[model samples]
Each structure stands twice: as structure tokens, then as C-alpha cells.
Target: MPDLAISATGLTKTFGGVPAVRGIDLAVPAGSIYGILGPNGAGKTTTLRMLLGIIDPDGGERRILGSADPLAVAPLVGYLPEERGLYPGMTGREAIAFMGALRGLSLAEGRRRAVALLADHGLPADRPIRTLSKGMAQLVQLLGTMVHEPRLIVLDEPFSGLDAINQQRLEGLIRAQAAGGATILFSTHVIAHAERLCERIAIIAGGEVRFEGEIATARARLPSRVRLSTKVADGAWHAALPADAVLRDGVWQFQLPQGGIEPLLAALIDAKAGIETLAIEPPSLHEAFVAIVGAEPDPVAEALS
Candidate 1:
């Protein structure tokens, strides 16, 4: 069996009287990038917090690197928070070094790594956090989170403030980290970004996970609609269509409810219809989100944004 980096079953969280996270289950594999996504307030951040031991789960269970005591296992995880902050008076190197120390690296080693990272990421060693651009500060924080070389990374909205160039760079860095044997969990609203970067994604809506699985698998769960253009007149193809098929503009289109399409093909062949072209357009994530989340962004996730 494959070793999982993080696993949670029936995870739950509450704020005041409200249940922020419902009994959600997560299974993130080692050396893979796991993306936690949702409309606003679907509880992505809270879930991360619980996994990091920053906030305890109200119920259920969680494990990291096979340990349930996340605090004890934290040394193996790197973290980038959604709410980013930096010491205004500290130089870029100093800020990075401080975070490394917090993650259990020695001061001297942290300094060495911080200096190398500053140069590698194109930030000046002497640049004060007070003078750096928002982007620069964000990058510095990222270096701090990663400098310790943990086995798992929980990044909350790592793409929030990144420009196009930085976004691409960050994506590459994330993939590299996973390649190096860390499980990366990042939260983002950019569906295309998540689609491009994550091997699998979980969409949480209404404080619960509405969907989870590979992108292709999720797409398969929904019915597939096909459009075909043929020689028949607009209304003439209806009689020959398979059950539940609809005709529009000399084209027959409908979702294959289940099972095989052999019957439909046989019907078309028996009608003596010469097929021109047929195409299946899969539903996109956004369409699936609307279908699963009730046509609106989760209120909390929106507020977090």
C-alpha cells in the first residue's frame, strides 16, 4: 500500500455556535500536491488549521506523517498561512531566519539557508521588510516557510497576491517540492490554477466537502452531453434517437444517463443516417461547482477572499 502523508476522517470544526467544517474526510498521498478548494467559507482554512495543530478539531480524527499529534509531527511540515505578516523592521534575511528558527532549525543554519534563498529567489539580503513590495514580502514569507525543508506543506492561498510571472514561478516551485517528496496542500479560488497544478481537488461548499476526486473522475460523475451534426433535418431525427435524446437544429444532443452507447449507435445505423460529426463536451469545474454548491459561492470562503 502507498504511504499517505496526511489523512483525516470525519474531521469537524466549530466557531462559536456554528459548525465551520462538517465531517470531512481527506486522504493526501505522499509526494503529491493536494488542493483544498471551495467557495468562500466552505472551511478550507479551518481544515488546514486543524491539520497543522493550530486549531484542534471539534470532532473526528487527523493524522500527519502517520502521527495523530500534529504538533509532534509538525517538524516534518512547512506552512504558508493565508493571513501573511512580516516584521517591518527586520531585513528580508532576518525575517526568513526567524521563521526557520520557529520551525526548529538552528539560528546559524537558518541564517545560511535564508541568505542562499534570498539570492536564489532574487531578493536582496539587506533589503528591509519595510521597503519590500507586497510581492517581495510574500516571497520572503514563502522562503521562510520552505527553508526548513519539511516533508509536507500546507499553503493557504499561496497564489493570492502573486503576479502572473510569480504565479508561474510559484507553481514550478510547488511542483519541485512535491517531486522532492513533500505533500503540498494549497488552497486557491482560481479553478484553472488548481486544475493545472493539482492531481486531485476537493470542492467544499456550505461548510462541507461537496466533491472530491481526480478532475477527470469528477467530470465522469456528471452526465456527458454530446452534440452531433448530420444530414437529417432539424426535427426529423427525433424519432430515431435513443431514449432520452433531444434534437436541435439538425443535431441530436443529450446526456448518456448510464451504461454503453452501443444501443444508440445501433439505432442510428438502423435509420440509415450517415453521421457527419459527433462531439462530447465535458462539464467544466465551474459548471460542476454550480451543480454541487447550489449556484453560489460559499459565503465564508467569499468573506475570506
Candidate 2:
């Protein structure tokens, strides 16, 4: 197993006597992309804030980058908050350099790295942030977050407000960072991004963890499906299918049996049924997420307590 980049045990938080994040455990391995997934108000942002030492947890403990005091090792961690914060009057280069400076980079070294990062992302280093488009400015903020080359990157709602094209760009950047051996921990209510990028994930619901494990394991909670279409619409072979099978769009779709598909295949063969199509469909992350969390929560609910 890889070394842990972030670990939390019994982490809890509350606001005005109301629990926002109940005791939760997390283990994020180094060099892996881990996602904290849930709808709004699931305590994702609160949990991240506690883990990053931005706020004190009401209970439990957290270790970041192996340091008991994450604030002490702040230089080794990069954070992109849900609220986009960039000085409008600062030039793109200055903005990036400012972030690097906070992480212990000298002004001169920060400027040097900022220039290269701006050019690499196709942003003009000298352009003031006020003159840049919203998407461009957001990218600039992300560049600033990464300018110091921190070992662990924590982002809250990174995809929020990004257009489809910019969202795709962000995804590529995340992959590139992980390829370079950075351990990334990001929280998102948007499930698709996590589904595509995460190796492991923790699902939060009602301010508590619903599940935590490999993405494949979460998906395995739901059974695979088999859609079969036979030459004859109704036959003895139909008896071999589960009682819950539903015929839709000229195909009989049902959950695969526990023992295996072999029994069903054999039963069909014995009935001498002419089969036109037999397709097995694995459960999707969305299906798994829904199964774990039940109905989706309100999208605009407050995630922070």
C-alpha cells in the first residue's frame, strides 16, 4: 500500500449546536487521486477545512502529509478554496507569485515559476486579472494554487461554475498532476468528475460517511444487468429469467443471478431458444452513488456549518 497523504479519525464538527460533520474517518494514499463526494450540505467542505487545519474540529484528529500540525507544513500543501480568490489589480504573474510567496518561495523564484506556468497554460503573464475572462481568471487561480509544486493538492468544488470546455481542461490538469506523483484530494458534489478521476472515494450524506473504499467496490454494491432478446418473444426460456425481469424496447432486462450467468445461459440452451442478443451491463457510478445515498439532496443546501 502507498503511504498516506492525509488521514482523519473520528473527525467531527458542528455549528451552533447542530452537527455539520459527524465523526468520519478518511485515508488518502500518497500519489493517488482521492475524491470526497456528496451533494450539497453533506459536510464535505467542513471536513476538508478541518483536515487542512483551517478550522479546529469539534472532535477527533487529522494528520496531513504525515504532520500532526498541517499548518506547520503548509508550504508542502496547495489549496484551492471553493471561493475563487484573486486580486483583480494584480497581474497574472503577480497573482501566481503571491501564492508561491505564501508557501515560502522567494519573490524572485516565485516570479520565475509563475512566468513558466502562465505560458504553459496559455495565459499572458503580464495581463492583469481584472482584464481576463472569468474562465481565464479561474485558470489563473488554479495556476497559482499549483505554482509552488506542493506534494498534496486539496481543492474544494473545483468544477463549480466552469463551462464544459474549461471543466475538461481542469480534468486534464488533474490527470497531469497525478501522473507527476502528486496526491490530490478534492471535494465535489458533482459525481461525474469523481467517477471519472478518482481511484478511491468517500461518500458523505446527512453529514456522515455513507461509504468509503475503492470506486469499483462501491459499484459492486449493485448487481450487473443482463439484457437478452430472443427470436421468440415468449418461450420456456423466459422462465429461466428472474421474476423481476422487465421487457422494454424489445429486450428482456434483468439483474444477473448471484451464482453466475452460466446457469441462465445453460437454461436458455436447454430450452433450445434462439437468442439474438445477450449483453451484460455493469453498474454505473451514478447508480452506485444513488444506491449509497438514496435520493439526491438539495443542490443549493449549505455544505458548511
Candidate 3:
């Protein structure tokens, strides 16, 4: 087994006598990108806080970077919370340096790193935070989270407010961080980001984990779907399709059989059903998430409502 950067077992927390996280467990492999996915109010932020020791759990245990005490390993970890803020009067460079100072980096070194980070990411280092756009300010805070080059990085809803272009840029930055050997754990309500970036994911809803493991494994919980279009209205090939198959607009749709599609394809060919189009699509992360959580219109929209 690989070394774990963060691990928790049965971690529980309640706020104002209401449960926010219930018996959550996680094992994040070092140098891997892991996503904690759920809808709003699904305990993702609470679980992240407990793992970082920002708040004490009502029950269960957790370890960070091999230490039972998360605070003791603070300098090795960088975190960007769900709520974002920076001193309004401070320049982008100054804000980054301040965050670094809080994590044990010298102010001088922090300033130096901030200058380079801003230039590398195409941001103005000397501009006051108030003057920057919302996305730019968020990016500035994110740069601060990495100024010290910590071994592990944790982000809560890092992509929440960004526009499409910035969201893509942030994804690239995340991939770059993991490539540099830092373990990244981020929480997101957006499935597409997790689908594109995470090697493994944990799906949480109603304060509990519904699924966890590789993207492929979660997707495999549902059978592949097949969409086939034929020129003929009726033919012997119809029998070759699964019982669940339905015809609509000259197309046949069904679950791919357990015996696979080769046999069905041969049968269709023999009958010369004039196959116009055929596609076998694996279950998407969005579909798997819906199946697991029983949410419609996707979790993000459902959560907002």
C-alpha cells in the first residue's frame, strides 16, 4: 500500500446540535489527486476541517502526514478554505507573503516566492486585492496556498466562483501540483472537474459517503449503454438486442449485454439490418453520481435549490 498523506476513520462532527458529518472515512494516497464530491450542505467542508484539525471531531480519529496531531504537521500542509478572503489594502504579493508567513515561511522568502508565482501565473504582483476581479483574487489566494511549496495541499470548493477560462487554468495548476509530488485533496460540487482531474473520488451526500474508489470502479456500478440506429423498421436483428431495448426515432437503445456486443453485432450483420450508427458508451461520472445519490438535474443544481 502507498503512504497515506491523510487518513480518517469514522470521523464525526455536529454543529449546533445538528450532525454535519457522520462517520466519514478517507485514505488519501501521497502524491495523488483525490476529490471529495458532494452537493452543498453534504458535509464536505466539515470533513475537510476535521482532517486538518481546524475543528475537533465529536468522535473517530484522523492522521495528517503520519502525525496524529494535525497542527504539528502544519508547515508541511497548505490549505485554501471554502470561504476566501484577503486583506483589501494589501497588494497581491503582500497577501501571498502574509499567508506564507502564517505557515512558517520567512517574510522575505515569502515575498520573493510571491513575486515569482505572480509572474509565472500572469498576475500583477503589486495590485491591491480590492482592485482585482473576483476570479483574480481567488487565484491570488490559491497562489498563496502554494507559496511555501508544502507536501500536501487541501482546497475546499476551489473552483466555485471562477469563470470557464479560469476554471480551466485552475485545473492545469492542480495537475501541475500533483506532478510536482504534492498530494492534493479538493472538494467540489462540480462533477466535471472531479471527472477530469481526480484519480480517485469519494461521493458524499446527506453527511455520509455513498461511494469511494477509482473513477472506473464507481462507473462500473452501472452497465454500459448502447445506442444503435438501423435503416429497417423490423428485422431478425431485433431479437439479438437485450429485452430492455427500446426503439425511438429509428434508434435502438439498451444496456450492453453481459455476453458483450460481438455476438449481437454479428447477428445484426447477418440480417443486414443496415446499421446506420452504433455506439457503446461507458457510464459517465455524472450518471454514476446520480445513481449513487439519487439526485436529478445533477447534484450541483439540486443542492442550490
Model 1: what TM-score? Answer: 0.82
The candidate, 2 or 3, that scores higher on lDDT is: 3
Give the Cα-based TM-score of candidate 2 against the true structure: 0.93
Ten-residue stretch with the least lDDT total in model 2: 296-305
Q: C-alpha displacement of 248 in model 3, angstroms? A: 3.7
The sequence of per-residue lDDT tens digits that candidate 3 reaches over residues 1-305 is 59999999999988899999999989999999999999788999999999998999999999999999999999999999999999999999999999999999999999999999999999999999999999999999999999999999999999987888888889999999999999999998888889999989999998999998999999999999999997776889777889999989778899989999998899889998888899999999888998998884344533432
- TM-score per prediction, in order, is 0.82, 0.93, 0.95
Model 2 off-target regions past 4 Å? 297-305
Clashes (backbone N, CA, C under 3 Å), per candidate, total: 5, 0, 0
Worst 10 residues of 1 by lDDT: 296-305
Clashing pairs in 1: 40-300, 40-301, 40-302, 41-300, 41-301
**Residue 291 alpha-carbon offset, candidate 1, angstroms:** 1.8
Candidate number with greatest TM-score: 3
- The list of candidate 1 runs beyond 4 A from truth reads 225-279, 297-305
Top model number, lDDT: 3
lDDT order, best first, reads: 3, 2, 1
Q: Rank order by TM-score, top first?
A: 3, 2, 1
Residue 80 lDDT, candidate 2, scale 0-100: 95
